[model samples]
Every structure is written in structure tokens, then in C-alpha cells.
Target: MSAVRLISNHTLKLQPQRSSSQLFRRHASSSVAEGSFTARRGLYASLLLLSTGALAAYYFDSRAAIHRYVLTPVIRHILDAENGHKLAVRVLASGFAPRDTQSDDERLKVQLWEDELSNPIGLAAGFDKHGEAVDGLFNLGFSWVEIGSVTPKPQPGNARPRMFHLMDDTAVINRYGFPSDGHATVLARLRARFPIFYQEGSEPHASLRSNALLAVNLGKNKTSPVESADDFVSGIRAFGSYADVLVVNISSPNTPGLRALQSHALLEDLLGRVTHALDEIATSESNKSRRPKLVLKIAPDLDEAQVDDIAKAILQKSVDGVIVSNTTVRRPSTLTDANKAEAGGLSGPPLKPYSLATLRMLRARLPAAVPIIGCGGISSGADALEYAKAGATAVQIYTSFGYDGVGTCRRIKDELAEALSREGATWMETVQRASAELSLKPEDRSAHTSIAQLTKEAEELMRLVDELGERVGGADPSKDNSATESTGVLPVVSNGTERSDFVLFSMANARQWVILDRSDNAASPCIFATLAYEAIDQGAQVASSNSKGRTISGTLMYRRGQLLERIPRHAEASEKLYLDYKIKPTGDKDKKLIWAIA
Candidate 1:
């Protein structure tokens, strides 16, 4: 009877069936978990879409709007000038700086140091003293990006307020005395950058990103000796394999004695050492036979003599190139900005006249092979094209870039391309035309060539021959001398048997000519002989026969136009050296016939 009652109680409890509610509660909790998981995934997807949209907006759009309307104004107003410059660098280095995506116009393509640049526009140095933003600057569409006035050692440079903005004049004046992170740090950056794109035994300039060049502007430390090339040499050793071009920064007026390097003697020594260092670097197996192009940056403040001296030295040293100007100390009276009076190197519009004049002078002095990079007072496409017309191979901008913001290079390129289209010329065509027309030509050498100059040369040659006759008797002209035969192509014998004293101005050319002057006084019969003058390192050789009998030979020379070194040639002492003969009378009677020896 007890067992039956227990069974009945169990059955009654089972009949209530509370397990159904428990099952429902479990299902509800499971549903809630699944809904939570789905909502979280949806939130993640939404966030991802928003982030991608922001990035696309930042990167795919034109940088000009942000640079002009937002970034530039904010930076300029928020921070002081130097600090603002620092901020700009940091922003560029951060890789978020707005970049121009427009392809460079085909007309803007040009050459710089054997490399085809996408555009002729480049960014000048001083904006990135430490080489902190080379890639960043290049990303903005500059065909060439020059970095640093880097020193052998770190320096504080000039005091605060060293940079002054002449907003009214659209110019900048900075006495930044080559403040730098020094060779070690800068070199590390370069080394770090090289392996990213280049492999072992490859050329940094020709192999990695050939369309754009990375040039480092080398400067001396404040304490280093001005005459000593130790700093530049060391810089070459440190960065030669890494940089496309190494710029010798001797033109900065802020440095105590830097400008003095432009003088003949000092410049020769400096260039010699720098070139030697470069040669060594090129030959070094560790450097992969990479020959870094060497360029000298000069000042716009140079005088005529100084400019001539520099051009001659550059030719003599076989320098790769020259930057027409760094900056000017001369303040134009037209500058209305109060900061114009500040003590610093002046740049921008005021510097245009000086820089352009200097460039034209240099173009007139140097051969077309040695290119001049124009920098200064370039704000517009017209300005850059003006430089091209004035014989500049490429144009660089500093003050204009600073004043105009990130769009400077693009704007200049666009404008330049438009100008080029209007003129029906390519950038190379324009540069070549200007170079051919404006650059110094062989035919029209120096201005000092005249008949009197030839007479003076004749006298010097005679004197030298007299001296040489004393040492190594004059060379026999009839002998089978291959060198002589090769040099004298159009041999012209003397017309008269009088055997009058004649100076043979011979070049390695076959052209033949004999110039005779119809003298005003019939008895005198003065002859004016003008010859082509070829400037050479070794002065002209002098050789002559003594009035009695014996002949002498040696080199006798003089400076041409206070610039080129004259090298006189001594023809065979036995035979005369004239190709043809002619005489003409001048309009002015009794005017002494001056034979200008070029």
C-alpha cells in the first residue's frame, strides 16, 4: 500500500511538466547571444566602410585644395615661421602630406645630369636641411629633390629669427648657417633608404628611381677651416654611393668664410680635392663603381671677375654642373617689406635680376656641356621658362614654393607646359635652343680677340722660342713627325721669299687662311693676322730661329680676357705654317692693324 502511494505522487509531479518553460528559457538565451554576435559584426563593417571612405577622400582627391585652404593657412597662422617649417617637414615625413597626382606634361620632360626628369622643376635646398623629407618632396611631383646643407658635424646654426618672411615682397631671407644633423645621421638616413629600392652592385642614381634625382647639398661646419676640403671630402666618403649628386655648398654668405672659396686659388684646391674624393668613391668596389655627379652652388653676389674665374675653374676641374645661385645679400630698394633690411641672404623676386644676370653671364662664359641649374625668384611658370630661355638646363624653386604651398611644383609645371604648347616647343627643345643660342660658342670666343692681341702673342712666342732654342734646339719640320703631320692639314707656304718673321697660330684643324692688311702708308705694308684662339691649360708654346741661324722652341702664353689660359703652338721651326693668303683695306685709314689672337 506504501509503494503504490509513492508512485502516484511521482506521476502527479511529472504531470505538472515545468521542463517545457526551462527549455523555452534556454532557447531565448541562445537567440539573444546569436543576435548580439550579428550586431557586433554589423558595427565592425560600418566602421570599416567609414574608415575606408575617409582614407579615399584624403588620398584620391586633389591636394591643392587642402594645402591652400586648410593645411597652409593653419600651419602658417598656428606656428612661428621656423616652427611652421618644422611642422611642414614633419607632416611630409609622416606621409600624410597632400600630394599632387597629375601626371607631368610630356612637354615638361627634360634632362638633368644624364637622367630624364619627369619635369624640369626641382625643389631647392634649405627647406629640408637634414634630408628629412626627400621622398616626401619628390612625391609632390618635383623631378629633382635636393636636400640638406648638411655639415660634417651637428650645429645649432644662427640664432632664432634667422628666417624672415617678406610676405609683401614674396620673398624669404634666412641666415641659417647650415644647421644640420651632420654626416653621421644624414648618412644613416641615406643608407637606410638605399636598400629599399636598390640591390647590391647597383647604381643608386641610374637603377633606383632614375626619373628623379636625390642630391645632397654638402656644407661645412661652423668651426671647420674654410680652405680645408676635409668636410666635403668626408661628406663624399659618407654619402657618395647613396646620393645622385653631391653639391658643394660654398656660396652661403651666412658662413664666415664660405664665399671666399669662390676665389681662384681656394676654389681650385677645393674642387681638386672634391673631385679626387669622387674618383676614389667611383672606383671603390664597395660603392659599386657609382660615380656621383658633383655640382657647385655659387652666390648671385659675384662680380664679373669672380664669375669668370669660377667658370674657368669649373671647366678646368671637369665639374659635373653648377647651380647659378644660392641667395643674395643685396637688397633691392624696390622691396617694401620691413624684413628686407634683416641681415641674411635675400631670395625671391628681388634676387631674380641678380640671379638671371649672373646666369646669363655664366652661360656666356661656360660651354653648353656644363649645365647651369637656375634657382631664385621663380614663382610662376613664366619665371621658370625665363630661366630656360636664359640657358638654364633646369629650374629650382625655394621662396616661391614656401609662399605658394604644396601646389608650387604642379602649378609651375602646368603653367610651363601651357607656355611650351603656345611656343610649339618641348622642354628639351627650349633648353637646347637657349643653350645653343645663349651659351658660349667656339667661333665667338672672348671679346678681347684683336690684331694687337695677335701681335702681342707673336712677341711672346718669339721670346719663348728664343729661350727654347737655348735648351732643346728647334724640331726639324721635314722629319716624319706624325703629330706635326696630323696637326698641319692645309699648309700654306709664304708668298714672298723675304723670310720675314712670322708666328704660326696653328689649331688641330684643316682650314687654311692668310690675312694681309692693305697699309695706309704704302711703304710700311703692315700685315694683320688674326687666328682662332683655343683656351687650354698649358700656355702656348714659343719657338723661333735666332737672327743669326740657330732655332729655339718652347711654350709662351698669356691670359685671354682675364679668363681663359692661352696655349700658343710652335710649328716646325724649319718650315712656315700658313694655309692661304689674302689682304684687305679697312675703311678707317692709318688705323693700326690689330691681329686679334683668339
Candidate 2:
């Protein structure tokens, strides 16, 4: 009985010890699982934080590599060219667009008109067709943000699929045809940007940013009269108060009869009326001190005659600047993209040669006083530099910007800065030097010579004039005669008629003669005789005398052996000259210039 009880007690004790060990194992397993959960939570939190930081950095930095290598490519691949452009504008307009955080290098700094730009880089007009993303684009480091081809009335523009991407060629073809929200809508958007307590200062820019400018590109409505400047005039009057620059966009290939306005007579009328409207605006109380500059946007397809006509109109109308050129209608053989056959204006790498050639030709024709803004297929810093060396005051980009995304402006500026640093030159300095060296000299400006070769016929005529003057008992051709040295009288016979009432006057500045008829009831009262003198290299100076010995002075430009007088409005005899002769007006009220073919 003693042995049996000892065995049973041992069994019970072993059972209790086994149960306690089981509880301990369960507790150990629970602790390990809890520890693993805590470790996983920590790892997940770390990953989230790291990813958030990385995304923030990438989102803020416009120069981030991901934008160029990944995001831009993905966007280009996913969306059609038109949709992609819309989405970009939407993002920028949403104020979520990445900003260029870096400051522009000093070498890239350029002066445009009265304002100083942080850089010479500019965004072209067609990008922000409705002024929807002006500030957003400015955030991307563009010093000049041009918006709108805004017409007087709203229009839907061309059909869908109007924008095409030439991926292989790095080009874009678009025929949006000035799709806009009209002048009223765009003006409201611009005006809404003003501060609540805004006050007009002595010098306020349209951009509202000290280093930037806002240019409004004005386009006529498709249904409007293509030959009229009324639409452009209305645009100026509406937006002139708010815009820093007003661009007359008459070069879009999509618009019918739009290019016809570029013809000599039509351009003269268009520029004349627009300039007159600007003058009226400038003299108004609202725009007393500030006058928005006028810029002409031309196409790249203009021939030599068309270009010369354009230049003449620009100079005559006193336009502030020109944007050389818009998208090209000509298809280059180098374009290998499937969309190359698209019937729209082509813009991209293929446009570079046409645009650059046009820019060079225009620069040579325009004087230094008028600045030329280079546009069309300017994608790289080298392209911008090439424009600068070719006398472009500034450069604009569109297709490259579309293909490259928000980083384009920064990339181009960086490239240009690097190039300028290597050359030890600034953008403005290069442009100024090129302009001075390449621009046409005063004496060399011949209407015919600009297009065709100059004939030796002018030299022969000049010699004939000298021989005729000597035979008429005039003073020696070699002597520089002052008006005071002569009797103010010259007897000359023309067509077997002797006129004793002809008086001689020497123009002090131009060294040319002015022959005024003192006879009463003469059919042609004023005769300007171009006397060939060895010292007369400058343009002719015109003068006329009244009864009180008062003198009227003006400039006479030599155009292919013919004299075109630029009559001074301040001259006392200007009204009489216009009324008596019924001079052909240039359509501007401020212009008193008359054309005399002889």
C-alpha cells in the first residue's frame, strides 16, 4: 500500500509541472508575434516618410531628373499632343505646377525695351492661347509670358486633332486658329489678378512682377473683315490699359486672308490705324504716362519683297518691335514624322533653319532702335545663342517646351548661361554687337537694292545732275555752300520754261538743296530738287520759306532715286502743304509725310 501511494503522488506532480511549462511557451510565442508586428509597423512608417520626402523634393524642384526622364516621357506617351497640352495648362493653372527655384544666371540677363528681364528666355503666344496660365508659366522662370491670340469675339477654332506631335522630329504641328475666350474674358482674367487695394503707380508693368512682362497677342475673329483693323483696334483699346505689350498677330496660316494683311498697302493701313489708336490711348488720362508697346508678329514664309514691305511699314508706323516669326507652312524634307503631312503650321527642330534665316534677314533690314524677338523651334541653349548672335534681342520657345515639360525654361537658361560664361559675354552684349554690325546703313537703304541687285544707273544720273548744275552757272560742285552764302535765288530752265521765281536753300544737316517756287497761282508750288554734291552722303533735308522768313524743315528719304518726304508735324507750313498739294495720307492722323515720286 505504501509503494502505490508514492507512485500516484509523483504522477500528479509531473502533470502540474507540464501544464506550467505549456503556459510559459504560450506567453513566449505571443510576445514574439507582438514584437514582429511592432517591427513591421516601424518599417512601414519609415518607408512612408522616405517616400513622402522624395516626392516632395521631386515635386518642388523643376530641375528634377524624374521630370525629364520619366514624367515627361510618360505624359507624351499616354496623351495625344493636344490633350497633353491641355492637361499641362490645367495643371499650371491649378497652381500645382513645379516652379523653377533657381535664380537666373547674370549672364542670361537681358534688357527688353524699358524693362529689365531676369533672362532672355520667353514663352511664345500660342502656348497660353487664352491667358489661362500666365502666372503659372511665369513660375517656370520665363521672363516674358505671352498669352492669347485673343480675338474680339470668342471662337472654337479649327477641328479636333488640330495639334500633332512629331516625336521623331521633336516638332509640333498645330492649327488652333486663334481659339480664344474673346477680349472681354481675357481682360477680366487679367484685371482679376489685381490686388484689392491696388493703386496705379508711375510705372506699373502688366506682369505685376518687376522682372517680367505680360504680352497680349491680338487676333482678329475669323468671321470679321480680314482687311479691316477694327478688331485689332478694339483689342488694343480694351487690353492696352492692362497689358505691357500688344502684339498684332496677323501671320497665322490657319486664318484665311490673314496673311493678305501683310501686303504693303494693307500692312500700311493696319499699322497706321493701330498706331493712331495707341497714340490716342497714350494721350488719355488713364494711360497718360504708360503706353503699351506695339509688336508685329510675322510669318516665316514671307518672300524678300514681303519682308521689305513689312520692314517699311514697321519703320513708317514706328512700331516698337517685331516677333520674327510664327509657325511655318512650308514642310521641310528633313521631317520624318508621320504627321509631317499634316495641313497645319509646323513648329519644331525643322522650323529652326527657316526661322533663323528669316530672323537674320529681318535683322539686317530693321534698325537698332527696333528690337526683334526670335521665335520658332528654339529648343536648346545653342539655339538661343545662335539667335543672339544673329541680332535677336530675345528668344521664345513653344514645341520644345511642350515636349520637355516645365523644366524646359530652366534647362535652356542653364545651357545659355554656360555658353555665355565660356564666351565671356552677356546676351544683350552679343545681340547689340551683332545688330550694330549687321544692320543696314542709312545710305545703303534702297527699296530696290533690298530685293534686287543695285544698278549702276544711279551713279550715271548723279554725274548728269552735276554736269547740269555746272552748266547752269551754279557754284563749284566741290564747294560746301551754306544757305547764307547764296542769294537764295537760282534761275533754271526745265522743259523749255524759264522760272525766275525759284529760290535756293541749303539744308544744313543733309547738305541737299530745296528749290521753292515764290510764284503765285503756280500749279506745282513746291519743288524739291536733289542737287548732287560730293559731300551729300546723308539723307536729304527739306526746307521751305514763308513770307515772314520763317522756315519749315523736314527729312526726305531717298528711295531708289526718288524722294519721299517725312514732313514734320511741328512745321508751320505742314497744313498748307497738305491742303494745297492734297498729299496722300499714310492713314495716321499724326503722320504728315507725303510721297513725291520725282
Candidate 3:
């Protein structure tokens, strides 16, 4: 009976163990199921956030409140500047940037090169270092989208921390050194774009877009010889057919000796080679007129003489246009940013003055046919207008675009349009007017007499006058008695062979007065004689003539090139007068003398 009871207790214990084991299994299964469900929920939530973010990026305009208050701040705070720039480029390439919805007003249209651009606003080169974002930038409403400081070979460019933001000055400084994706890569991309762009019902060729143009800014590789034209020539051959304009970028300060290309000899060689390459491309093309316009981009730090040299080279080389200017190494005192001392080219408001001055100087030297594109420190429509007034056919924005965002082009266009309307003008009209008014006119550019030349001529004239005076003053008063009937003065008129007029007076102090008449011939010989007669009548001292005739002794004042013989102290010396001329006749039979001011 004890054995039977123990067996029953064992069975009872086994039953409880089985029930507890089943309960534990159920709990484990339930926990696994809940864990899997939670993970799936988290993944869905993440996907939703990503989709929302992508949508916001694509749909929102760069000018939207979210972009200004949120997106911009987020980008600036989250990423380093150079990386942020990369990210922006990537975003644009991905077609996530907002589309330019606004069409330009008719008044905003302008002509650059042979094309008629929808607006005068354009994106300058440095903004797009590669051809990766040409169409992307164009989508943002830039009529002219310039790409690449493209080199013949790939280059990393400068070093880390090479770019800085001067937030206080709304500027940027960069030592990018023309980082480019070589000619091969850039040319391949452009070639790809070319076919698609010109296809039926596709985006128009950059040249076909009226005033819209696509330009490639060619740069020399850091390791390449600075003076060699091979790199730029290669670039022209590679991209000549694909671009509307080809910009030879020899102006970047970051490059060790790139700016040296601005030297007359080097620039001549560079442009000549590039032009030859362009001609070759044009010759190969079925359409002869479809060649790219060649432009030269120069630095803002150039002096007047340097700029003049560049202008001469441009005219000599037959370059199509010039972009007046790239960044400057100069740091203005007005720069309040700590980055002011950074070692790189300075750009933004500090650059405006330098650029405008350079542009004005360049305009005065360049012919009206070659247009100048003004760049540097332009942030507003007013600034664009200022550039126009200074003789720019078109204006480009760079530092301002970087600081402000993609909406910069649109904003500038709006502002420019409004200003143009206020003046009852169009962009074409304003540019035309500015070009006509400010550019060097043919008359102003004509050969002028240098001060040295004028001085030399004046000295020669005075010497001749002195010899003539001796001839007249030493003559016998008795011989010319018939000629001295009126006031005992002889009137000598320059013969008809001369273009200039002059008068000679004999003074009592043994000094002869030579009136250099630089006036028009309206003053007849009779009038000139009256001047000498009037001086004697004004209590004038004279030499004692043996024939009882008096010789006038006093200074003669030529007022406004009109001969006025006056007694000493009769007129203030401060009066605006030509230089004094003294002459004593040398007894020459031809008493007529000529006066030449220049």
C-alpha cells in the first residue's frame, strides 16, 4: 500500500511540471511575436519620415518660409560648408530642387552674345565646378548657367578648410584652385546632355534658348604648366561643340601662377590656340554659324595698365567677350568677419567696388562691340542696375547665390524687372543705353596729344615766336611807316597756308609781346590790330620811336583764346590764361605767324 501511494504522488508532481512547461512555452512565443511587431512598426515610421523629408525637399521653393527658416538653417548647422555645397549639388542633380515657376517678364529679356536670354541674370562659374548640374541650375531660372573651371585632368584642389563663410559681410573666401572632373568626364557629360537637349520636343539647345546660354569655364590643371595653352586648347576641342560660350578662366588667385596667363603674351597665345580650336570645331560642324563664343575671365585685382593690356589682347585676339572679374585677394577694412584674414580670394560686398572699378576701366578701354559681363558682390537687382550703368551687358551672381540659396536668381530677376519698369525700360534697352553711353566712344578713343607732346610742341612754337619777334622788333620803324599808320602798330596775319592765328606786339622795355591766338579764325586781322591799339591808349609805356611813334610796353592777356593786349596788372594773374609768349621780330619778310596749342 505505501509503494502504490508514492507512485500516485510522483504522477501528481509530473502533471504539475507538464502544465508549467506549457505555460512557459506560450509566454516565449507571445514575447517573440510582440518583438517582431514592434520592429515592423519602427521601420514603417522611419520610412514615413524619409518620404516626408524627400517630398518637402522636392516641392518647396528655395524662397519658401520653410526653406529660409528651417531647411537653410538645418543645412548650415548640420554640415560643413564644402560638404553642404556637395549635398546641394547632389540634391539639384536628383531633381529634388524646386522648379522655377515664374516666367520672366518681356522687359527682363536681354541679349548676350548672339542669343536672347529670358533675363539678364546668370549663374557665374564657380557655383558649378562640374557639368553635373547645368540643367539643374537652369531649372532654377538662370538663363545663363556656366559650368566648370574644368581642367585637362582631374585635380583634388587646395586643402581642407579651404572655404570659409563671412556671414557678417555676406561673403565667401575660397582656395578651391579649380577642382575639376577633367575634360574627359566633363565632356562626356556635356555630350550626353547635348543629344538629349536637342532631341525633338526636348529642352532647347542652350544656344537655341534665345538669350539663354550654357558656358564652360575652362581651367588649367594645378600640375600643368601655367604658360602652356595645351590644356585650354584641349578643353576647347573637347567642349567647343557642346557649349554656347567657352570661358578661359585664368583669374583664380588660388592657383599658383594661373593669373600670369593674363599677361599679354601668354593671353595672346592662349586665346589664339583656343580660337583656332574653336575654328576647327566650327569647320567640322555641318552648320558654320554654330560655333561657341569665346570669353576670357580675369581677376579683379588687376591695375589699370594690366586691364588695358588685357583689353588690347582681347581686341587683338578677336575674343568674343570678357567677364570682368573673378574673386580678389584684397580684404576690405569694412569686412567685420573673422574670416577676412583667410588666405584665399575674397568675394561678396567687398568685391563690388573692386569689380565695378575694374569693369569701368575695362569698358573705357574695350570696344563697344565686345560685351562685358559684370560679376562679383552682386546681391540685389539694384546692384545689377549699377553694373549695367557701369557698362555691363549682363550680370552674374556667385557669392550671393551661395549665401542666399537657389532662389537668388529668381529674386534678382524680380527686383531687376521692377527697377527696369520704374525707368520705363527693358533689360535690352538698359544694357544698350549703358553700352552706348559708358563704353568708350570712337571720338574719345581717338589718338590724343599727351601732356609731354603738347609741352614739347609749345616749346617749339615759343622758339619760333622768339626768332620772329627779333625779326620784327629789330626792324627799322622808318621802312614800315606805311604799315604802322594806325597807332604805330604793325598787324601781321598768318598766311592762308596756316590753320592757326597769332599777333605780335613791340614793347617799350625792349621786350616783344607775342599774342598766341589759339582761337577760331572769326577774329579778323582788323580786330587783332584793335587789341594792340587799345593797349597803347590805356596809358601804356612805349619805346621812343625816331619817327615820333610810340611802342606799347605791357603784358597781353589772351582771354578764352581771344587776343587781348593789356597793360601790366590790368588783369589778375589768376585769370585762366594760356602760357605767355614773347617774340621780337627777326626781320623775316613773311610777318604772318601761326600758333598751335597742340
Rank the candidate models, highest lDDT first: 2, 1, 3
Q: Output the lDDT of residue 96, model 2.
A: 80
Model 1 per-residue lDDT tens digits across residues 131-161: 7877778878888788899998999999988
Q: What does candidate 3's lDDT look like per residue over 25-139, in tens digits?
A: 9999999999999999999999999878866664655555555566766887788879888887887888767767778889988777666778888889987788887778888
Query: Which structure is stronger by lDDT: 2 or 3?
Result: 2
- Model 3 lDDT-worst window of ten: 570-579
lDDT of each: 0.70, 0.72, 0.69
The sequence of per-residue lDDT tens digits that candidate 2 reaches over residues 514-596 is: 34333221112123211111002234233332332222233444333222332222111222333333222212211112221
Question: Quick one: best lDDT, which candidate?
Answer: 2
The stretch of ten residues in a row with the least summed lDDT in candidate 1 is 570-579
**Model 2: lowest-lDDT 10 consecutive positions:** 589-598
Per-model TM against the reference: 0.69, 0.75, 0.65
Q: How many steric clashes does model 2 contain?
A: 0
For residue 453, give model 3's deviation from the true position in Å: 16
